[model samples]
Target: MEHPSDRPAGSHEARDLTRTLMRTEFRERRSVTTELAATTVRRPPRSTREIENSLRRRLGLGRLGERLDPTPWLWGWLGPLVVTALAAVMRLVDLNHPTRLIFDETYYVKQAFSLLTLGYEGDWPAEDDDENDAINSRFADGDYSDLVSEADYVVHPQVGKWMIAVGLRLFGADNGAGWRFSAAIVGALSVLLLARTARRLFGSAALGTVAGLLLAIDGVHLTESRTSLLDVFLMFWVLVGFWCVLRDRDASRARLAHRTAPIRAAEESRAFHAAADAAARPAEPDRPAEPDRPAEPERRGRGVGVRWWLVGAGVALGLACGVKWSGIYAVAVFGVLAFAWDLSARRAIGERRWFTTSVVRGGIPAFVALVPTAALTYVASWASWFAHPGAYRRQWAADLRAAGEPVPRPWLPDWLNSWWDYHLAMWDFHNGLRSEHSYEAHPITWILQLRPTSFYWPENEPPPEACGAARCAEAITNLGNPVIWWLAVPALGVLLHTAIKGRDWRAWAILAGYAAMYLPWFAYAHRTVFSFYSVAFVPYVVLCLTFVVGWATGLLRPPPHTDGWLAAGPAASSRRGGWRTDEPTRLARFLTDDGSVRPTPTAWAILLAVVALAVVAAAFWWPLWSAQPVSYDFWRAHMWLPSWI
Candidate 1:
């Protein structure tokens, strides 16, 4: 926590860079130009301690308690790895179960098959009531040409279908593993991605691992990971996009630092040398000429073509959108964040026109990097469809021209026109969908996971029958662990309040991540959406909640309070600023010896009790979450919350 002024100027690069970047941040703009200047600017480089101290002071976390970092060693990685491995094993074990298509897989799988044969989803026989009979006549005979002329209305995007088609192509459409392969892979990858993201955010590999483990063990995520549903793929890409954004943030700042430092030093040195030369020039040639000041350091570009990070951010966002249309939310939110980084950059350099520079240099280039890259990647996702002529919706443009209406746009190629038309149709279908579904979930309940969707149900298949138990045995339910979901409620409240208070940028950043994926759903809740859709942003929610818990536990320290009154108070304050002007703290301090206050062991025990309660709650709901078979009576006993039931 030593100040940068304590360090030599040569080694103060990191803090200087951060300061430079923060200078452009609108929140820090005034401070950039005002608070920091002259001798005070030279300090020993700030470390992890200094960073937290500044944040704690800014966010008023000092008034609450010493902040804590929740990066657990064993719990972080080992626990999460064990949980995730268990999930992976479970998914791979009964992977071929039922040996048949389940739920909406029929439509998606069939469409995928059609895409494989005809390069587009085709119309199915109007009266193929019996699936076996229809497959025998159509697919078995390889008569895919039986598809009708009309395009089928599909609600979701093609990226997911393209994923499905990959497995189908590799394993053939007839096998169980063929349809489920992509889901399993994406699910596992998400676990890995979550772990990495958590590691980065917490600066703890263990915390990252724990986050992944929690996600892996969670019933809903496990089930989706096992299933061939589009939502799982959507979650994977969205998480990947988020991780990339985080990387981009760190990288951009590093680049700004590298580029700005030498330039500043060199400028200072040159100014020194020039002034020395001018002063030494001898007034009226009477005095001996003083030696010129030494040459200044030269600054170098951090290495460039363009900022690769902006490009990376764009590509990640584009890939997210490619998976699900809802990924558009991430693109918009992150785009704003990236621009905010620009503002930080401009203000860091003391540029009066920081906003304008951000708009012209940072903002404009960012759009160029993000927009075109995303658009191209999104379009490229359709390569399979483009390669195959018979894919569903592939020939829409040809169909239009054949109907004798002039092709609407003469400036584009036929395929591009056809693709544009297909997008319009897809958009219409998604927006207009109002189909009633038995498991449709409301958007509001998504946060709490009320009424989780059941992905698999077996008739006459008790856990005993499936697992060979003497009694009802094992099952898999796609419900969240209740303790986690329940705690998230208060966690979310803490996040919202912190964001509004502008206490910590991390809190605000995490909140932005949630809003990107979740807020957009409120508008479409009337459609047949499900609570499972919230999985896309669940990792961020977990991170935000963890951050709050850490802050509450005093993992991160606030800025040192220079308030004179505290030292002047009659009651000695605690070594750490855990006690405030409150009655309880004051009383506790009054009982202290050596002017040092310490909470009793009993108080510490109470805190431990709260943690113990949360763990117990988690264990109680583990069965329901894991889909293990329990008697109906036992299941009812766990339903402490009526809303949960």
Candidate 2:
């Protein structure tokens, strides 16, 4: 008997596991790529040609053809640690600000308190406006249980509330720290997640660190990181789902390597045995042992391991949906992307049944992972509601059952029925939510952050009385840092070019994330919206910007003759190259080939300039972004544009 250690990597059990993953990967890749391709429209300048050029020239496309050589230190564990530390500092600093309900926190916080007290969100009396306000204000003194009875019609999902409840449980419901815990933790983790993703995609620590820092500083992200809202939670889970899908891709590839070896070995052995038997046939013509024949219905590309990651991805995406219905978009996008990766793997191995096996092996297993896992997670998210019959919409199942409509007995369960009813009610409320308000915003302005939501407004105390200035205003506004956001517009252009021209999968990944979080809001322009919702996409935008900056810096090269020329160029540009006898733009020629900037002298200048600009910008916006008190005139002066006012 063979020892377990001595057993071939392609043994039956191993192959079985690989086959399972292979099947899952095949369909997942197709689904994700097709959806991604559909959502993407190739515009001019950043079209297919641009992608080709970026790959060939900018990022060294040819090198990939030789070997799978990843930069060693750049992609290892160190990048994540650095990124995580920076993210934690940015998110954790002065986290317990405002010390009161802000914006939609008035709704979500109360809902969580109600859930905690009575296991449901009880209706607030419209008549006792002052009483309700008093109760809300005196958060610690209120009888929270008195707020519940029948369920309140909430527009958002239970998952976000549950997350908020966890924080409330830990830090006490009255604390601002409790309310903002969900966003802060999720946002910090997002920085770490994006950092790891960038390192893996770009193979550079500098790039990864830049990505993390940019995300850490983005205004929208910063605000979300300091708030208790469902959007931030939505962002967190969608990112988690994305990461899990990537893991599934890698795991599937590893499985392929393990499963293919035995088939190759067996085929080679059979061929050698047949040739020998043929050579010795003359010695015994009457009766001889039959030559070895290859196994019938040959296996497809070596199987990867079982696709546990896909299942995990499904569960994560499901929880995302439980947080917000919009998460469905992410699920759809990632599902298709996972399958596309599988198809490419099979095609690379020259499998005859590449498409068939990809579909057969990858499709069903992917569904098994995604469909049921999502369904279950979504149901499970409503556990609190299910546990308490008095919770809003919890009795719908009982009401339906009492009506006795002879439904299929096997197809129905109380948990599923209650969850379904709750969703139907939630959907109805979301669709007809057309109420207008003083600050109600349209989604069209979300991209440019035209209409940011103001979260806090306290009674005026004089400058000295509060912090500073006359009538101090402690406000929490959802806005992104201009330096990061303004730069991202151009960065997005670069990333789009890189994705299409260079066929850089990393660029495509960023583009996909940005498109998913931002574009979906555009479809809902008629609905009341706010810039705060854009926080979900801020990390992607910052990441894209940082990546482009890193790319620009990474391509710098030394000039042919003058050392200053190399210093003049970006740090990462090619060190040697010619203009082919003709000059281009003065900026282009000086920067790219001539190498205008050298590390010795130019680095200090650039670093100083950048730091100075950052400091000045930060100072200018300090009063607004950080809730610093200033005169109304001073505040007006800071508002550069009419929209900002």
TM-score of each: 0.71, 0.74
Candidate 2 residue 544 C-alpha distance from true site, Å: 1.7
> CA lDDT of 306 in candidate 2?
62
Q: After superposition, how far is residue 494 of candidate 2 from its true place, in Å?
A: 2.1
Per-residue lDDT for 500-592 in model 2, tens only? 655555566677787777788777777766778787777678667755654555422311111121112232342232223443343333222
Best by lDDT: 2
Candidate 1 ranges with C-alpha deviation above 4 Å? 1-84, 126-152, 166-175, 274-305, 459-477, 556-630, 634-645
TM-score of 1: 0.71
lDDT of each: 0.61, 0.64
lDDT by residue (61-171, candidate 1, tens digit) is 232234223323333455456656755775665565545566557677777776666666666755645754465345433455555645566656578888888988887
